[model samples]
Target: MEWVLLVIAGLCSGIIGALVGLGGGVILVPVIVYLGSVGLLDGITPQTVVGLSVIMMIFTGLSSTIAYMKKKTVDFKSGWIFFAGSAPGTILGAFVNRGLDLPSFQLYFGIMMVFLSLLLLIRKHLKPVHWFVKNGRKTTFEDGTGTYVYGYPIWFALLLTFGIGFSSGLFGIGGGSMLVPAMLLLFLFPPHVAVGTSMFMVFLSALVNSVTHISLGNVPWLYTIPVIPAAYIGAKIGAYLNHRLNSDSLVIVLQIVLLLLGVRSILDGIM
Candidate 1:
């Protein structure tokens, strides 16, 4: 029954992560925490949950990235730039996260979720208003099937991704919740491009972070095994759905998920 529940949760989380670039941790972490809080799962520490979540992210991120790649929506150059900053941050966060107590971890997670939710809610007002680098490349690029007309400051992206990667490593999230919104609202990336690129970055960061956690013996492999296949299938479905939705609709969907996840996480954390 526990495995069944985890599979169901993994399916839903994968779909959301693929569609919105959230990386499934937003959904999975809270659910596992809630189960453990209620005594439904034994010996499930914060470290254990974070470790398992990263392992699941490896599969979801890879599968979703592949789906997006087929549609030619991923921004490889931009994704690599983000990964450059994210890698070290992820490593540092993995080591730092080992020291947090369960309650403190939950409280911080709740606060982070709520903060991300608020950002998404007011994202429209935050539009791409400033260009930090005037001499940056302004040319449009084609990704086989789709062409993206976007300009991004490489320095700004590196700065932002470092923080995002830190959060990903520390919180066991994909960092897409923050990355997707920043790409769209700040960098003006096309919605599909942001989602795809974010997935690629999440895959790389999560893979490294997962290895770090595994070396520390944090992952509950027995419980995490069933989630991978279901999450992979769901991610493909989500990527298919992402291509069909318009930007405004996608933003609305992402905001709603962030809002709900935020509320639930906060409530769980305080209680």
Candidate 2:
């Protein structure tokens, strides 16, 4: 009976995560905490939930990557750079994460999630004011965030990507929520491709973070096994929907809703 509830919650989480390009940790973390309070998790701590969420996200990444790969949306070059830096950082974060109490962990996680949520809401209103096609390269659409005619300066892009990687390292997320927006507003990556490629980058980041968490004795295999398959399935569903919905408005709306949900999740964790 309890397993049924867990599975259902996991499925809903997967669908939301896939649609929004998040690793689902924000949503899952809150649920785990709530479950713990209700004695639904059978004594699972929030830290265990974080660890298991990272492990489950691996399957989520695989499914989303496969869906995006079909359309050739992956940008491996930029992705690897972020992954390289994120790997070591995630290891360091896991060690640091171990010392914090439950409330402190939840508080910090909540704050980060709330900030990300607001960023998503802001991205919805930002217009794509320019398109860059240089050397016959892939079309790059830049939102109106930078004054440079060539879009955001190269240094700025690097910094934003580094920030995304840093968040991934700190939280065991793929940084997809942040990456997708950065690519859209800063790098001018097309929405579809940005989402897909972000998943790839997230995949690498998740792999690194997951391994690091496991090594640090943080992973909770018990609940993870139940959640991952459902997450993969939800990713497939989201990928299918992504191809079906071809409007900027829809994407914006979806992102906004996700942002609000992220906010809600964070608030729940904190309170």
* lDDT, candidates in the order shown: 0.83, 0.66
Residue 160 displacement in candidate 2 (angstroms): 3.1
lDDT of 1 by residue, 57-80 (tens): 998999999999998778888889
Model 2 agreement with the true structure over 176-246: per-residue lDDT tens digits: 77777767775677666677777777777778778777877777677776677777787788777777765
- All candidates' TM-scores? 0.91, 0.81
Give per-candidate clash totals.
0, 1
Q: Count clashing pairs, candidate 2.
A: 1
- Which whole-number lDDT from 0 to 100 does residue 4 have in model 2? 70
**Model 2: pairs clashing at backbone N, Cα or C within 3 Å:** 141-188
Error of 1 at 8 (Å): 0.8
